[model samples]
Target: MNQTRYPELAGKRVWITGSSSGIGAGMAKILAQQGCKLVLHYCRNETGVQQTLQTVAELGAEVEVVWGDFADYASLENVFHQAWSAFDGLDVLINNAGIVTKSTALNDNTGAAFNRTIAINLQAPYRLSTAFAKACIDAKQPGVIINNSSIHGQQTCEWFSAYAASKAGLDAMMKVMAVEWGPKGIRVNSLAPGVVPVERTAKILAEPKMAATWTKTMPLQRFGHVDDMGWATAFLISDSAAWMTGSVLTVDGGLIARGGYPARE
Candidate 1:
């Protein structure tokens, strides 16, 4: 575990959604190192969440675990209440819970998968952020929101209709939330990561040809690590980004910056 650089964040309360694995788990670990009290959420994956809880606890964090199915939208309010009351109230809301539904538009003609993707990826964050913002306003306290977005929101390829739409909506809604909450001292922002290999993609992304193909398009010449996202999240919530809001912090290692041009010699 890394040492806490932002001592100011010590003792702050945070709720991280989908913390059972991947980027959410990474964020939980990082926030734990920062000495933040955490409310970790998971839809399922009890084992994974427990592992995350144990790891963060080992880092000396006061941690709690919660669960909710975002697809059942009506249940989110109660879930948010539970998380809020875990530590009295939360100081930060990391809307990191999402699904990556990759299917062609034709395959999703019924829009079931598309709707499900929107529900979990976009609607859940919207609902959760709204709850967090209201609670902060009622308590008359400043707050922060970090929406875990994707490069697909800005640029995309095929088989991402549902995924892209949800992320794009998230980014737009994040901006509006920032605008409305700015005067109230609640900051909203999106963290757009590109080509970060998590547990789900690590094996495939590690293949020599696959690794070379992806990294070649990125000027940084390497895939992103979960820790990179952890650092980025810390910065967003830290005083370092006090004045920043309604922004999309792109941590893509130049993947999007390079565009579709062929690799140069």
Candidate 2:
């Protein structure tokens, strides 16, 4: 953690949404260590944001915090403005705010949950990235956008209709934006994580039986850690990936590669 993998990241201004806890928090910590000035956003996790603020501050990273409900939709532009104004301007925008809604296609006939999931997971990022890109273009500065997408975008299972659709849409939008904005020096990419246990899933995923069963399907035979996603995020925005854009980086321990087939007898 002490090593700075990307020295060029130092002094870069970054804004990360939904960074109060979980994978977002992990990404914040790593970016802070890389010497990036940060604008951390949260919806309702005040306490979680405080912890993130303190941790990053201790790491000597200049940081600020903003809050907004992505479901509100209309207010998202204001939220992005708040984050942008925090550091005068931002060099990177990490669209990581999303909700995972698991529901069968037939269970929720009303599609209320699906709409909510799309609003927060897909629509919000769309708006934010648009705003970020416009601002960067107006300022005539290069920028980077990293969408914290999911493996569900490429492949999914039952009870993930809404989650899968949102992520899939996100990936598609990311590619279009990368293509449209690449000429303007705005790079866009996505990180598709698989089975990274966070606070929300810690209890269930920690069970010996559940852990073993899930891990067995992965080629690497292990669940992903938050730090793993964090490191990948860093790399996506780093100089090492300077030529990378409009692509999805899958850090899933080969789960998707193993396919949906059952293990060998």
Candidate 3:
């Protein structure tokens, strides 16, 4: 179907990491709706990713599933090759795969824990973006890489230092690439989403006490949906945001608009 209102991503080759569930899955669906050819990259959730691929297939998208651990760089080339074999023309790369094990304080952070966090959230995306960028440049096609980032990248969290540091690096990397790849038609940016309620956060949000606390504390008094983040990403990576790059677009529900202090106990 020809898109009149939307930028018609039909046939545009799109590669997404962390696409098994949550915001990544949601964005995959939105991209499918726009007729994109999708490469869904998931970490360990094969059964779940197959389900996502089935749904995407139903949407008339050309779909391929690739499994590559974000912490393992050796397997990245395999993923790129597998997807590229089918669709040689790459257009978009969404670095959405990341991992965060909560630590309440820097003292709580072990060397192993910090290493794991940086490896997956920060280092892997940087490596993958480099890999994807090189491929797209070699193919001589304009590409867009949208990093799935967090609001914490812009602000500090009390107990989540590991997660914060990884995201901070991600934010810095995206900015550098916007300048490096812009000359080649590759736009690099990040979606610094606040709390998104989905499989990833559904259980936590469903906890009545936690939900109530955050709701009262959060300025918007509500949690954001994965679709909210996904749609914004769709726009940013599309021609609609053709002029946008190196930008950290926030989708928090007025969370960042107010003072950082939470509601008093």
Candidate 4:
């Protein structure tokens, strides 16, 4: 795919969490092509993070990788601070690290799984966004924040209650942050993606029947690609979307509009 270089993004410092692989990695590559300096974060995927760094560097973009566990608040804070200082300052923050535990029932004996999900998906974003905003405000610099939300935030599937709740909370948080930070020249928004085939969803998509069902139900008759999400994210963080904030841009290939249409038997 041909890369669209956004002149406005050139030299802008960006920090993306969970960028070792999947959507975050895709966004990192795209932004790198746009000439943006990137600080990529990963939890434990050192190999994946290194691979992403190599890929971004090949695009002639300045990039750095940081490791942190979002489930730990103190670790998360340290990661953000290190990233903020990596490039002297940060112009954008992408809250993308999240976890979705399969077969997570609401009444499961232990609430451990549920708590971890909320902590990583919702709490991490909340804390990181506040830190990013406060730093921007203190420096009197304009900034952008994009939360990597999910279509599940609005529509739920079986066994995804905790994940959905976390995403929904994230969307709500974005709106509130936008309202409170917009006046300070900070923009906050959420990008709710549909079924994008990435490392995390490879198992689900490998199920022939399930994959076919998604294809049939989506109006576009196909699953979303990582680059598709990457491009949308890049646009949102760009000056082109200067007038937009507190909005949840759904990149779900018309799945939500279909309202869960039944797949052919």
Q: Write the per-residue lDDT of candidate 2 for residues 97-189, one digit (tens) a residue.
A: 889999998998999999999999999999999999999999999999999999999999999999999999999999999999999999999
Question: Taking the candidates one at a time, how many backbone clashes does each contain?
Answer: 0, 0, 0, 0
Which digits, one per residue and each the tens of the lDDT, describe model 1 over residues 1-265? 3678888889999999999999999998988999999999988789999999999999999999899999999999999999999999999999999999989999989999999999999999999999999999999999999999999999999999999999999999999999999999999999999988988899999999999999889999999988899889999999999999999999999998888889988
Each model's lDDT: 0.95, 0.95, 0.83, 0.90
lDDT of 4 at 140: 91
Output the better candidate (1/4) by lDDT.
Answer: 1
**Pairs in clash, predicted candidate 3:** none
Q: Write model 3 residue lDDT over 1-265, tens digit each, in one string.
A: 4222345666788888888998889888888888888999887898779988998898788998888886876777777777666676578888888876687765664577778888989887887788888988888788899998898898866767889999988999999999999999999999988888877679978899999976886777898887787688778877789999999998888777675776775
* Cα-based TM-score, every candidate: 0.99, 0.98, 0.92, 0.96
lDDT of prediction 2: 0.95
Comparing candidate 3 with candidate 4, which one achieves the higher lDDT? 4
Ranking by lDDT: 1, 2, 4, 3
Off by over 4 Å in 1: none
The 10 consecutive residues of candidate 2 with the worst lDDT sum are 1-10
RMSD values, in order shown: 0.7, 0.8, 2.4, 1.6
Better of 3 and 4 by TM-score: 4
List pairs with backbone clashes in candidate 2.
Answer: none
